[model samples]
Target: MTADDFRLILFTLGVSAAAIVLSLPFGLALGWLLARKQWPGKAFVETLVMLPLVVPPVVTGLVLLKLFGKKGPFGALLERSGIEIIFTWKAVVLALAIMAFPLLLRCIRTAFEEVPRHLEEAASTLGKTPWQVFSRVSVPLARRGIAAGLVLGFARALGEFGATMMVAGLIPGVTETIPLAIYRSFHAGDDDRVWMLAGVSAVIAFIALWIAGRLTKGRHPF
Candidate 1:
């Protein structure tokens, strides 16, 4: 690859990493809620968590746009605070995080559910606080699941296109993630760059999947 291609790849990597960093904690928290809690509208909340997985990407982008665009509610708030999300790298991160949340939550919920309740009870009886039990016992036992969730989230972030494009606007060196760049290039008839980017994205996704698989091996009881 040329230096320019390498630069583009780096941009994508940076944006994807930023997105994953932003998404992980929230995803874990949401997943824990889904797995450990039962309340009114819990099923609705679970469905909401998975909404991004089923919604059309363009529609997702439109929803975000309406909520966060320059004249939108949050957009006005951020504008008042002198912070902007539209047409920026932060916007890309936001879009990616939204799209990746479902995968991360799914992985983490599975991990949380796999933790035996008896163990938690045992820890509680030993005077360990609930937070301590969660931090020391539950989370430790579910590290592999968390890792898998992270990888899946990262992969989803990496492949995010429509939402990123709509939010970030395909500005090169500013908001053009690899997936968005590929779409732009293809539309502009830049076959070489399009193919190269497609291959690069595929390779990156495959690597993430491979890492997830290796981490999951022998970790699940089944």
Candidate 2:
């Protein structure tokens, strides 16, 4: 592979990994909440959380752009701090995180829900606090599902193109990931490069899906 292609692969891997790491904590919390809690606005909240899966990726990216553009509230504050996010590598990470969040949350929530509540009750009876039971009993039992979720989320993020393109602008060396690279090479009539990149992406995606399947096979989410 060419140096540029290698750079794209490395950059894509780095940014996608970063996105997953950044999202994992919040995903865990939200997953637990959705799986275990019952509140007045719960249905609305679930719909909101799931909106991204149904919404157009470009629209999601546009919303992010408006929220983080230089003149926008969060963007302006960051701008004063001299940290640019729009169309940067950071944008790529952010797009990946957002785009992949729904799948991650769904898998995590299913994992948590699959944990028998009776086990948590048993832990509580042993004088465990809710948090303690969650940490010691629930999380351990749900590890496989969590792993599956992470793998699936990574795959989704790796394949992300629309939202990422909208937010990150597909800069050649800076933000071009595997999907973007494939698109670019195809347009440039570099068929050989396209095949190489496409093959690389397919292999990675296949591995990810295989692992996720192994982790969650025969486990149906409610």
Candidate 3:
């Protein structure tokens, strides 16, 4: 309703979108590899991928902070390059993307697993290269699940709070997202603003889930 509220909504949307875009390619590649390939340390790799899901959000944020803080290795490298990540919107994107990754990877992996191998083999016999078969056949067959994963990732990113707060620090009109705004409004005793932001968050989450459900309908049991 207010300019600040509008800004918060926009920031949340931007961060969520950035998170999805950042994670999708990696999720798809890793999911496909996990689904279709067998290799050493596969279980270890999977457990590592799912670590963020099991760890406390604050812990995840702290790890990120230590890795990207000014004195840390990556942070120092970036600083030397004149790139700052700490306490920025980029940090918000990183936090959300990390938190949303496991969900997206799991969904996409399941979708890839559900694609019949025989279809790929048939395409291969018809002179289709592996890449061609995957692009034309496997991907299309698994599109519903991929779309669902994308929607779920976006919803998760939109609602992310703990890690984002730890990294971005709730700077209004800079890195403040919907959840951060709600926290600020509630703490500031702005009950009307809190309720408004909460309602908007809930509505956005509901719409995302509904779209995911529709996209995955009759496609996979997941």
Candidate 4:
């Protein structure tokens, strides 16, 4: 691999990791809420959460662009604060996180739901507070699922392309990730480089799935 290829690989890995880290807390909270709570508009909220999964990547990217572009409300506010997101690595991270969020949440919510309710009730009866029960009993039981969700999220982030391209603009050594670099190489007729990058992506994805499988082994009922 060339120096540029190495750089792109690192950038992609960094962005994917950042996206997962940033989304982790929010995914956990939403997953738990969806698993355990019943409320008005719950279905509506779920549909909204799952929207990105179904939407075209370009469409998602466009929406993000409108919301985070320089003239957009959020973008303007951030600009006033001296933080720019559009056409930057931050945009790439945001795009990946948004795209991967629903998958992560679904896995985590399923995990939470699979936890035995009686265990939580038993803990409650034993004078354990809700928070204590959740922290000690529920989370531990669902940890495997959470790990699966995280791996899935990371893999999704690593492969992100359309939305990231729209927001981050494929800036070399800045926002160019493995997928983007591969796309550039293919279009530029760099067939060898394209194959190499594709191979790298495949290997990374396989490693992530292998780790996830190990984490979830014997835990899932299936």
Residue range 40-141, candidate 2, lDDT tens digits: 888898888788899999999998899899988888999999999999999999999998888999999999999988889999999999999989988888
**Steric clashes per prediction:** 0, 0, 0, 0
Question: What is the alpha-carbon lDDT of model 3 when measured against the actual structure?
Answer: 0.91
Off by over 4 Å in 3: 220-222
Model 1 per-residue lDDT at 132: 94
User: lDDT value for candidate 4?
Assistant: 0.92
lDDT of 4 by residue, 1-222 (tens): 888788788888998989999999998888898999998999998999899998888889999999999999999999999999999989999999999999899989989999999999999999999999989998999999999999999999999899999999988888899988889989999999999999999999999999988877788552
Q: Give the range where candidate 3 is weakest over 10 consecutive residues by summed lDDT.
A: 213-222
* Local distance difference test, candidate 2: 0.90
**Residue 134: error of model 4 in Å?**
1.9
Give candidate 3's error at residue 121 in angstroms.
Answer: 1.3
Task: Give lDDT tens digits, candidate 3, residues 35-142.
Answer: 999999999999998998888898889989999999989999999999999899899999999999998998899999999898899999999998898889888899
Q: Estimate each model's TM-score.
A: 0.95, 0.95, 0.95, 0.95
Candidate 1 residue spans exceeding 4 A from truth:
none
Please, what are the lDDT tens digits per residue for candidate 1 over residues 1-222? 788778888988887788888887887677777778888998998898799999988778888888898799999999999999988888988899899888888988999898888888999999999889888988888889999999988998889888887788888888888887788889999999899889999999999999999887888563
Best by lDDT: 4
Task: Estimate every model's Cα lDDT from 0 to 1.
Answer: 0.86, 0.90, 0.91, 0.92
